[model samples]
Target: MKYVALFLIFLAAPALAQDDPAVAARAAAKALEQASEQLDDADSARDRVKALTTTVRAYEDGLSAMREGLRRVSLREMDLRADLAEREAEISDLLGALMTIGNSEAPVLALHPSGPTGTARAGMLLADVTPALATRATALKEDLKEVSDLRQLQQEAEQRLTEGLQGVQLARTELSQAIDSRTDLPRRFIEDPVRTAILIAGTDTLNDFAAGLGEITQDEEPGSLPAISDRKGYLELPVPGKILRGAGEEDAAGVERPGIVVGTRPRALVTTPTAATIRYVGPLLDYGLVTILEPQADLLFVLAGLDQVYGRIGQVLPAGSPVGLMGGEMPAADEGLSQSGEGGGAQWTETLYMEVREGDDPVDPLTWFSTDKG
Candidate 1:
């Protein structure tokens, strides 16, 4: 019965509200539900794209938390069952002893080999142990109840996970649609179609293409985008992810790039780190889809390898505006589980290639971006 203290190991689990997976799961569910409600009225919001983006991110976060909670519940339940099984013999003995003591007649229990003095001493001993025995019994009962509660929590979480998955999918679809139809951002200047085409056709490398970047637009009217030179080392990453490759780091092929590579979840949202004008938004050579943003004169932030490009060329976007989403579908239940802390399976597979240029000179992005900030 003392093994009831084994349940205390759960205290070391991740810090959730009250350190309970069920509570954390319920909180996640509430947030997910609220995001869903917002998604329903997204069309009525002043900035539908922003509202939908928030909803999509909320769903993503909620789903992630739910997955973690389910994992924790599973682990805790297995451990509790194992503890109970390992002490099965001890528990049986305790139960048997308690039963024997309960069923004995008071006169028989009172009888002692050493006479009245011995009997009175034995009675005093029993009274001393009663409180401890009752405490042990209570602890065991509580442990057993926790096991049952964990099982039920798992079932409820599975249903919530299903609903959360569906909700996120819908939110993503709406956000994509909203972005496609959006035409509210101001354009810095009109891009000259002929000049852009000529510039791309004459260039054989990224450097050459960037060298003639200014030639693509003839209007070149000064926009209202404020200078971000002071934000050089304070800008956040365009998306939530980990830096997989440092600037100029060699790959398996011994090739190096000037910018860092970030790996993130599939379909992760990408936003501008600072207010800038959209210099270019289209495919260029082997980089797949690309977006070139100019935050200041002669400076460019080039993001490549996007699945779908957002915003039109020459648009002046505010800081934190949605630029694009990474390629790939969200992992299904089985795959997602395998990607959690309890899992050793796959991880973030999508990568964003980023580079910063100062008038045709490729610069290291780490110096210009804050990789440690959210």
Candidate 2:
């Protein structure tokens, strides 16, 4: 009876089994750790804004991984619990059998009326059964232990999420300020405000305004930049997002444009996909804020719906240079807690309209840019 009591107590302690989620969690944590270290390194970087940009992007990647890992951890826990629940009756029966055996008299246990031959055979069978029973008990213990660890990981992740989210926001703010104070970039031509205003007032559509770019800035130059002809279908998106509406696809309002609609998270960083001259910047028509880049003669890349804009008209920007940020406020870290089982990919509610054109004619943006990556 004393031995059975000790065995039951051992069985009551939790253990472990499958480790797929733990593997993912550890990888995510590593990414977060690297990003955290990079955050510190960015402070002393010579190009402060550029370093901050990298830091923010790293944090984004880390947070994204952590969110996915947490989601997987939640699902794994749920599955183990469900499996254990289904085998509850079997576990109860096993425990009851052990109790019964422990309560029996030691001399009566395995004793048979057939004498020594029967007793020896019974003992041999008990040895084989005991190993199998112990194996099942160990497996159950591991499952319980895994469940406990998953729950603890989840609780601790909230604090990490809070720190990451706040860190990214601070990086973004610093990048914006750095950009404002920057005077290092060269300009191709100065924008004539009077002509720009006149063009805006006279134009009825984006096509009309874009067609008159020559009238707004007569000294515009894009010759030094290499032609993007070789880069056709290879250029990355200016922002990190998924294609919400493919080129020419209609939205819920049933209005379809030749351009694509990208779904992105709040305050996502926007960058130049390739070296290009900024032809136009600021609000245009109903589009919130727009940045028009000319990579080659007769080719234009237009991105609209920005919360903030960087660089001015005619400033040549290199590939991957920070251009702007997507609109919408970053959600509080606590707000993400309820999204435990739903990965970060599902959280994009903000939209950015991206378009491409040959002169004033609208064209399929996908033809010039690749969508194989985020």
Candidate 3:
């Protein structure tokens, strides 16, 4: 029976911890500190960029946790206020009764007890109850003090939330600045202004544009480029998200597209899964801003649906370099259907359309990245 009772107590501990706002706040703080340490320990520019992005995300998460803690504290304050009000009412009633009895005449007081013997018994009862009343008054005073302390805590939490939000904003600015400064990469291709202009003007669709790019010749063969073929099924995703559509999947327009769509958080940072040279970074038709990267002499990666592009054309970028940011809210893919309906609703704010091609042939991205389908 003792062991069973101990086991039950252990089982209930986690539930109690979950209810504690301070526990969540501490966890968020710890995560933020670890991310900051990673950012400080980063060796390469690419690693530093990723670390900075993670730190920014951690800061945002910490602020959210703090705000949740504040909310819980506010709720507790309300409960304390209600309890204090009830205690005050009880104290008022007790004081009113004492005043009424004190103002009564001696004869009236004796009559209230019925006779001499009854009056003496009543006095003895009052003597015993007076101590109990004093204890209740002391408890009420302590409750009032606790309510004051709770109000102070509530104020502190609100102030901390405000400061935390400002700190997160500052951290985001620093991350962006770090990415902008780290743009040095060994180039494998030279920009062909004439051919690029012709392709930009002639292409009617993304497929055509990709095909046109494939035909453009490189200036020199990059012997120093990393072997991307050897790293198949081991590449990390450019952004943290879930795969929404696979290669050759039918899109909302009922067209068979040759890319995967990933659903990510709004304004999420897009990074390179492997070392690559920037072939192009500009706006394309319907896909918003686009970035094209060549990981190898024969392999090209196309990324679209960006709100802003970071690197420039012909720039060499190492693996994990920041490429762009996901776009914000936009109109739905189809107009007649609700956003929640399949293919009819508003386009997701952070949907990344990625395509991997080897020598003009589209390849399944799932074969490259280790993704959790479940």
Best by lDDT: 2
- Which runs in model 1 stand beyond 4 Å of their true positions? 1-18, 110-118, 334-347
Residue-by-residue lDDT tens digits, candidate 1, 120-212: 987876666555555656766777998999888878777888888888888878887887887887777889999999988888888888888
With a 3 Å backbone cut-off (N, CA, C), the pairs that clash in candidate 2 are: 15-141, 15-142, 16-142
* lDDT of model 3, residue 228: 76
lDDT of 3 at 5: 36
Residues 41-67 of candidate 2: C-alpha lDDT, one tens digit per residue: 877888877787788888878777777
- What is the lDDT of every predicted structure here? 0.78, 0.80, 0.65
Can you rank all candidates by TM-score, best first? 2, 1, 3
Least well predicted 10-residue stretch by lDDT in candidate 3: 330-339
State the local distance difference test value for candidate 2: 0.80
The Cα error of candidate 1 at residue 371, in Å, is 3.1
Clashes within 3 Å, all models in order: 0, 3, 2
lDDT score at residue 102, model 3, on the 0-100 scale:
64
Worst 10 residues of 2 by lDDT: 1-10
Cα deviation in Å at residue 53, candidate 3?
4.1
